[model samples]
Target chain A: MLLSRMVPTGFNDLRREMDRLFQDWMPGDGNFFRPSVFPAVNVWESGDTLYAEAEIPGVTMEDIEVSVVGDELSIKGTRKPMPEGDYTFHRQERGTGEFCRFVTLPMPVNAEKVEAVLKDGVLSITLPKAEEAKPKKINVRTS
Target chain B: MTTATAVEKREGKVRPEPTRGGRIYSPNVDILENREELLLLADVPGARPEDINIQYENGELTIHARVDSRTEVGEAQFLACEYGVGDFHRSFQLGESIDNSKIHAKVKDGVLTVHLPKTEAVKPRKIAVKTA
Candidate 1:
């Protein structure tokens, strides 16, 4: 009875809405049950650089993968479940599975200059914008 | 307290209580019992090792973890937010068979593991069978 109630009633509804949004934004069936993004990430941009951080607990640096292709940055990793044993679980809310998140950068970035780091199970990525992509100020000349 | 009535007592003390002013979220955890000890595994993502606190008193074991706030990046805007960060709090009742003084805790990769050892007298022991 407790387990049944623990499942949020609005979860499926939110999943459906997210599926629709993902379908229009990216090409795919947008399966909501098995989401493409796990270990939710935050992405933001500055003047000449973009930053992305992902919360991935129980994952090592070796398992985390970060790459920049064109204006898109992708983060991929897997969270393996606990070891098999004869232990009874009291409460298990965390899900374990492979996840990949693809984010489109707002500005063009230099892929070669991208830096990624994983510390305390959180992955941070920095992408520097290409020289030509940086905003330039133009001064008007008075004749 | 081994009967069905004991269940009510356990549930009564497990209610979530907010700490101070910030929002308090219950951390996901797994409890395992063996012949020697009870192991508690909790998922407290984004919490630094130094921020986790464990306390035991009067047969009650509690965990308090303060997750560090997100790093501040200048002019950064969140595009999508699926997980909200907050402090974690949870408490469990330990029976008399447990040795509270020997409990140990450690955090790694954002996971906290607590070990609660059973008292020597409470451990299962083999009794000799003899013909009278």
Candidate 2:
């Protein structure tokens, strides 16, 4: 529920990512319904910006693929395995695999002029308002 | 509290910290979820894909990171260091219909993303009843 409210505004997205990455070890076990470590995202509408961001850590801009089909958003990428040799085990955990996720927006987005930027492992895409979605400016003269 | 590793052959004394060497560990992970899927972005800097491990048990997801500090990319002198440099661990609990087998993961930059694909069977399905 809280994930939906994450507004991916520059650094704020960084903070949210830090919290998500560190909170796991900070608490005991039992919260499975937690947010996505990468597959999840937050979308919001404020003023004239319709922002959406996907959490994709450890990956570089070259490894990910993002595109919009109509109102559906798709993200695909692969995670490479670590190269460390054999070692005495204490605790081993981390997920690695091919990932393909899609999200269909309730409302149509501006696909022609969409903007995508990757920063701090998070991908933020700004869907500009289509000419139809933009608020119409009317000239009013004392008549 | 005292912990033992191996039993003593002489006086039945418990083993000390037998496991003293370092190993790869799962880094801390946090996941935020929206209506579509869970957002699993983990902080695992200085860790390559081969150095990390992830697993799912019961309904929880776990991640560990192993540090390889032996190789020093000697560039800058150490002045102020705040980033974590040891083995780390993290996990999360998932739903029954989370399709555990289909769970996917990735790491870009330093964040690890695990995509938990929700089972289509569990998702709300539209059914229409017709009476003739």
Candidate 3:
């Protein structure tokens, strides 16, 4: 099923870029951020840690990988297509493709200490902060 | 003026139905309040909290859920499905009203929760007025 989309600000830049890159090639209409096909992910932050979650329902621990470089974070994985068998056609809307999305974190993350857990088709990652980046209290000066 | 004629008219006027099987449904969700933060709860059956995702890009919050065990096949002998494996998405609009500096989230079992505390200058507070 096609998700509804209303143009956002400066959408013309996107059209220009598409045309500049594909002017000589077949103008593909459906090549973009198709949310339905790939798993959904969420990211949040606390005092010192940055958290990221990804949905890969049918995959196992081996299917997911997470890594952080400086303030840039990358999450990539493969979602295998459904197997062929005795399944009469009704609807096939879910996406099956290799997906890689790069996201930036608000604070520098501890790439060495990043922890990832995969359960129930979801992958959760915790990126702890370097000690110096965490919040610190300053003592009041009475002078 | 006849039953056959009425049925024909109805069929001719009704629009052709679209396929209904290509959907993903996460269960009812709840976001609760806490002393220090707020909680976001979403029920995703056959899903692991580890496999769920929550992200804050600028002020936009996006939630995605994926389950690997349940899948939909094209043909079926006997099929009854309440939920099938596919991608699920939900998002929110955020402004300076939230503490972009201190937001947290966690998922346990199949429920996903996000804790967004009000900024220090903005959190709920009570004031007292002296008797005039």
After superposition, which runs of candidate 2 have C-alpha atoms over 4 Å from their true positions?
Answer: A1-31, A35-38, A137-143, B1-108, B111-132
Judge the docking of candidate 3 as incorrect, acceptable, medium or high.
Answer: incorrect
Model 3, global lDDT: 0.51
Q: Give all candidate RMSDs, comma-separated.
A: 7.6, 19.5, 24.5
lDDT: the better of candidates 1 and 3:
1
Candidate number with greatest DockQ: 1
Sort the candidates on DockQ, descending order.
Answer: 1, 2, 3
| Top candidate by lDDT | 1
lDDT: worst 10-residue window of model 3 chain A: A1-10
Tens digit per residue, CA lDDT, model 3, A18-107: 644665664444435323334444566655676666655445556556778898778777655444333222222233556675767767
> Which model is ahead, 2 or 3, in terms of DockQ?
2
> Each model's TM-score?
0.74, 0.42, 0.43
For model 3, how does the per-residue alpha-carbon lDDT over B1-132 read when each residue is reduced to its tens digit?
121232223221222122343344423344444334444445454455566777766555557666553322332221112123444455544444557668777655444556677567655577888999
Cα miss at A100, model 3 (Å)? 0.8
| Chain A superposition TM-score per model | 0.70, 0.64, 0.69
* Per-prediction share of native contacts kept: 0.53, 0.14, 0.04
Cα shift from native, residue A70, model 1 (Å): 1.9
